[model samples]
Target: MTIKSLSLKRKKTAPHGLSEPTDLSAYRRIVVLTEGHTNPQKAKTAIGLLRFRGGDVVALLDSQTTHQSAAVALAHDVDVPIVTSLADVSQPDALFVGISPAGGRLPPAMQGAIYQAAQQGLDVVSGLHDFLVDDPALVDIASRTGARLIDVRRNGFRETAKHASFREGCLRVLTVGHDCSVGKMFAALEVERELLRRGADAKFLATGQTGIMIAGNGVPIDCVVSDFINGAVENWTLANQQHDYLLIEGQGSVTHPAYSAVTVGLLHGCAPDGLIFCYEAGRTTTKGLDHVPLKPLTDLRNLYEALAQARNECEVIGVAINGRRLGPDEAAQEQQRVSAELGLPACDVYRDGPGVLANAVVALREQVVD
Candidate 1:
């Protein structure tokens, strides 16, 4: 089959959150405003969600790739139209700031679209570190037009209360990773899905933009103040105390120089009963920092377990590898090697399904009972 045809088929069968109903039901028709950066890697929030939940996508606003199919610009076949301006799109219920540029600052070119969207009485959803509500012009427009400005990143600022002590009723599984973008969220969501499929009560706790978009509610851990990071995570965990399992989405790696604080906070906050360490196959060094070589999977696992155990008894039950860049044979070999070396269940959750990791979590619970 052609590449386009294969992508289309994958869209129908891929286990990437499309099978589940989304919490964004109120936003039935939405426009993704990505402007200059239309590539999927840059416009991940918009492209990723639309790839899985295309029914909600009305159009992608990218002046650079106007009139192009979203599949062509994003490298994923969501089959949505790309319009140059809001004028080109039919009235949409909401306009989402889709691109998350480095430093999290809002791009100047995108300002016009935000203004236009608000003036047209469309709700604005922004995930940038720079809040749209902070801008005087946009705020005035939104206030006058009765358009809601939703900032997904401003989750923990409203509450001054500290987190409750970590309680131990339900089994909590956190997906810790060796580096950024190594499929931590993917593994956590897949494991949650697998557990639910087997008739277990489970909820996937989101800690990032994409996860928040998928679940429709979550604290953006990275955007919270350093002092309140743990409190934010603890609050989310306690709210979902009724579940049999809570699959917590983890953030950056503990070894990552820039984001280690976020990782440390999450580990102590949730006090996960178990962790699924995620690593990218064949990635020898951390992304953007070539001098920082990756530690052995065993070492990473030990570090995570030790940190978690310091607060509460925690174990590294499995390893989830991101083998998207590796061939099938090589990926399988790496999975086997990691499993043997770490002495834990190991597999790429996306490629091999989350059954191995799900089974590992189930077995660990059994051991705890015994």
Candidate 2:
């Protein structure tokens, strides 16, 4: 059913917490090292940062795809050069390990390149589970060269007693998804842009490494201790208290075997006024774990709404479909099917614009007032 048809009522209280936005200006001129993996699906961090970050991305280091532009490889029409080695890059402030391989391990062949960057006194940034700072060789090199090794996944945790404080007049909308890499961040960003274009006081809150790189301020929620996951979210929300709308980026899926905790934590953390459920069309199961089948749209909606209502009243305002893999006809058909099944506005935010979901948020806000 549509959000208006849902029985949930809005809570009149604000969540409690403390948060400080991150500073990304230090990463002004960066060299993204993708090496063997340079495709969009694999080099998500590199592509995202290059696409959204306001800083100057000097080059994308990929030996195999040297001489080709980012537009050719990722099909995004970015002007950054793809170089074979760091020697080809000009003066850069940082060297970012931009690919998240299957096991999150640093590629063996790329270690020498990282060392080279460290030797040159350029800051090194990595988002893998394996922390580069922990490596003795890299640590020693960075210490000697006066370069900093920033593990985005591990660094930046401000221990605070403050939790998320729900703001009275702000409209907080979170983007939830069926699985990781389902375009939750992309949808949330587009929605925020659309809201701003409509003259709404909207703000986008980043929750992951790529988003943090883009927004210049956000907590990598998955890196935080489990005890403080929700607390981190609440604190981030509280930081944007002045905004009329806060479009918070969501993490993993509730059904994901490995990352469900992050999903549930974010859900309760933001205590959003509304949610936009994101799903990738033509995907029936979780990535990597083929055994876990994706829950149907109706079941997924019920699960999200039930959990949200248990804490504070919330509803699934609309559906954002990621139709990157599907043809136009197929995407439209899938969108129509999902809308009919869930009885909610459904569209691909990237292709169709975020108007549908943005309209839903505006309508909901007006409904609350009336």
Candidate 3:
């Protein structure tokens, strides 16, 4: 019951002569491996955009039955390719990987395969959420390999602006996750009000719950995601309704379909200047810790390097913190570590709670205008 098995059946076969890849020298392809449909749409949009700009993309999507099965699926996704490894991927132009915490330190089999790939001289880009890596050994591997390991949750704050510009003088912000993060919601609203008070036309877009709330917060929980997604095209189509600056908020883990659908829709519609990823640093589900602790790639200088591989079309801004209080010191330290690892200014919402961040957002908006 805990372990779910999944096998992919290519809906359609590739064209004959085209079945065997030609010289990839001119075309750099990217293969995206994921656990199920949760964020495949989002991952696909990102992968596609990056490829369209130049690189080639090959996505190997998967569906893990239980959350615990994510690692298993990732292991398979990676190893399967090695078993049927590409002829020219040996010297790939670049490689990107999205790792979930449950997938826990790439399985030994996959690690061996990766080592082999490295022997062939392939540099890989990998990502992790803040809470996923508490293990020292795994972090070490990322460091030595020179892999771009990132904490996806917060890659939005500092890095997103590269993709979508903020209103000349407005705040560029977003709320992540599809499930309601009352903490993040209130924080965004207060920031908006503060920006308006300062005279900036701060534009805000809500994905999933936040979007539903924008249409009207009383939305039924059951239809939350569908209503938001269905209404998105119409909402975006409305002119004069657009703001000089844009901020999008994601609610829920990257593994949720709502999260995937909304993010993909946003990218397909009007890709944000940047992506802001908010995660519960210590938030735990029945499946254990939800975030991947990526201790590796700490010295790479910012998560942009890793995100560039995950989704290059947009700049990534990351915000990380432990949503729960284990201890004041521990929470603060975690925030510091996350910020340090990503090479961005850390927003320790836990210290002053949401109020301080709300105020800080106001200050950031003002600076943006200046």
TM-scores for the candidates: 0.87, 0.88, 0.39
Runs with alpha carbons beyond 4 Å of true place in candidate 3: 1-172, 177-187, 209-211, 214-242, 257-259, 284-313, 318-322, 350-370
Q: Give the lDDT of residue 275 in candidate 2.
A: 90
Q: Summing lDDT over every window of 10 consecutive residues in candidate 2, give the lowest-scoring window.
A: 9-18
Model 1: per-residue lDDT, tens digit, 226-251? 88888778877888878878999998
- Residue-wise C-alpha lDDT for candidate 2, range 282-341, written one tens digit per residue: 899888889889888778888999988766778999999999899989988989999998
Error of 2 at 302 (Å): 0.5
* Model 1: lowest-lDDT 10 consecutive positions: 7-16
Scored against the true structure, residue 334 in model 1 reaches a CA lDDT of 89
- Regions of candidate 1 where Cα sits further than 4 Å from its true position: 1-25, 156-167
lDDT of 3 at 332: 74
Best by TM-score: 2
Every candidate's lDDT = 0.79, 0.79, 0.37
Pairwise lDDT winner, candidates 1 and 3: 1
lDDT of 3 by residue, 1-370 (tens): 0000111111221211111111112224443334333242223222222322222444332333243332243322222231134343333433434333332244333344343433433333333322212334444554454432222221111111133322344334544432324244434444455455567666444333223223211111122244344234323323213454545444333334334454443343343334444555654431233453322323222333233334324444545343554577777787778777665445545344444444445545455445
